[model samples]
Target: MSGVSGFDIFWLIFMIMMMQPILRQKFLEAARQRMIRKLEQKRKSRVILLVHRQETMSLLGFPIMRFIDVNDSEQVIRAIHMTDPDVPIDIILHTPGGLVLASLQIAKALKRHKAKTTAFVPHYAMSGGTLIALAADEIVMDEHAVLGPVDPQVGQFPAASLVKVRQTKPLDKIDDETLILADVAEKALNQMEYNLEELLNGRFPEEKVKELAKLLSQGRWTHDYPITFDEAKALGLPVSNNMPEEIYELMSLFPQPMRQQPSVEFAPSPRRTPPRGNGKSLI
Candidate 1:
């Protein structure tokens, strides 16, 4: 048998590397088309739109559609018109909160629509992203689906993140479990209510709004830890509270997928300052 020369080996390696992107792009486009097909099969859209951003491919790598800035509201509106000028449209969302303003706009559209508008979050929907989900007539999340704490987590103004602006003392300095009996989770949740009040001011009444905000923020925040589908139901989001036997068997550590858009929070990736950084890098 004849063996290939060293030059052939180098050429082969380069060829393989070049082929990777082509193959990946083809796979991605196919996946996008498949998702659209699945939504079409749902039978509820005169205009069926599947909107995914940073959590998926980020709209062909547009910088504006950053991981946290999903300007989906306008996109959804446009898709509805293009797909079906007169019929109702269905939009699917998968995002990890990107831009607060963008999320709010998307949520507003969902709430204003008289037609049936269903929001499906197959993965985690956190912060402002969750706001968009809240506007939906019905939300579909699996038993393992995760919804992040709605507490505004900011760092550009390390002075304003939920765990920051409010804590007069350092948060990491947050006393250990035994010393902190006030359940940080509960307090943060109360704060979440206040923030939502400002965001949804005239949208819902104070009493109803407060109740809605508290229930949604009803749990602790920890990375890689998600509430069971039942736990979310108890928290009171308008999701399809079902847990099929198969999904229940899967580990609950996985985060729900979320695409991002752009905005203040996404302007710069926020970093936690020891809640009291000494103006020097700790790591």
Candidate 2:
């Protein structure tokens, strides 16, 4: 009674270890279902809600809820099938970017589908997301919404990316860690070059693709520079700049799976044994 007992402490730790998965799964499943329901609810228009956030999933334990999962394409396909094929898919994108191959696959699917594909960006769509948006017939954005460079990037440290351009001394002068990272960065940069070139081949004109890739890779924050609404339209993508408040609110009011009753909340992905971390969000 005077102090905490060992048994109680062990019990508490065990409970936490066990509960974390349950809670995470529960939350993600709920979110997925809620969003799915919202997506399906608009069957009248045949819209499939696609949300990919290019930001990191989590930083310091909390998920950034920005980034697209390649795996999500499978789920999205399933959702589309469940709806009437005639219904067009409306993708609401607000992502910075993600895996190049993953983004390419999503964009390819969008392009292939007979259903009309349209992208709406309440905020920003950069990189891979930009690629996907480009595939859409129409892009809807507000004045504040931004589209970023579709450049390729590899995760080299801030230093290595510019070393060759500014190497101050001989190799031996460089720190071991920096040297190692530089080697990795060199390889990564090469891969990025290949990746950007490959992705842009058919997606954009060859001349514009190469030029944009170079500018974008070295752009703001290492991935892309900001491209405003006008630039997006100039890219030959149809654009919609304003969404009236009433229509916007109607869109927002779609049933939230998280808020639904447990009985009808929707089935969690029981097919997944371990928890899938928040199934790629576009917050």
Candidate 3:
């Protein structure tokens, strides 16, 4: 049968059409697996993500609650302990920040680990997220990646905003309750600055460490302001714009949040709070 009969030709065409979707799906699955494997190989570590997606579960178009909270600190620590101490770690961080102490805990682990640690920010790492990145020996970012102000947020307001009340407003005009908050804000900012300095001290000079702590925790910019790779490098962070190609592919696996803005209803307190659950919080 050098040439297929008419019936044979029809069957071949039908078979191709039927197999297209199955073949496409298999191809995608294989591609995804390959991407993950490549990412692991390139980084030379098991990749872990600590990300917070901004959108929250809403009711009638208004965010009624937040789902992501729990810091996977314990889990992360376990993973690190299980790994050979000499092996490098690459943490992919994309968070809006969380409990300060939880972030600090993870940061301390990374700082103490004998292996080189790198933080990869594909989109954004903010607040406590910034704290974790600070602990890493190096920060890898894409041109579009963002790291934000790490100033602690108290209740519904930024600690800096509360502190500003004391700096910019006349003392007499401020209420006793507002004054109390302002005082707490100042104390929080100072404590954050101190801790931040400690985290960066070994890697950076005294002056540079002070500068970063001030810029990140003292709120020179808005808490949500996005500091790109160039801006981060200028600020004396160990930032490299060069990123692995697999990072983008990996990030693509996580879909963007449905909401454009973070839910304002559930404000994380200044103190360290446990994560909501295993639920994801990603940029």
TM-score winner among the candidates? 3
lDDT of 1 at 261: 57
Give the Cα-based TM-score of candidate 2 against the true structure: 0.54
Which runs in model 2 stand beyond 4 Å of their true positions? 1-45, 52-66, 80-87, 96-101, 150-170, 186-204, 218-224, 234-238, 242-247, 250-283
- TM-score, one value per model: 0.56, 0.54, 0.72
For candidate 3, report its TM-score: 0.72
lDDT of 2 by residue, 135-218 (tens): 676778877788776544535443335456336668767788777666665665555555555544665678877765555444
lDDT, candidate 3, 35-137, per-residue tens: 7678778768766667555332232223232222444788777767877888888888877777887788888888888989999998888878888999999
Order of models, best lDDT first:
3, 2, 1
The numbered model that scores best in lDDT is 3
Alpha-carbon RMSD, each predicted model: 16.9, 13.7, 15.5
Pick out the ten consecutive residues of candidate 2 with the lowest summed lDDT.
53-62
lDDT of 1 by residue, 164-201 (tens): 42355665765575224334444545665665655444
Which stretches of candidate 1 lie above 4 Å from their native place? 1-13, 46-66, 70-74, 80-88, 156-206, 214-228, 241-283
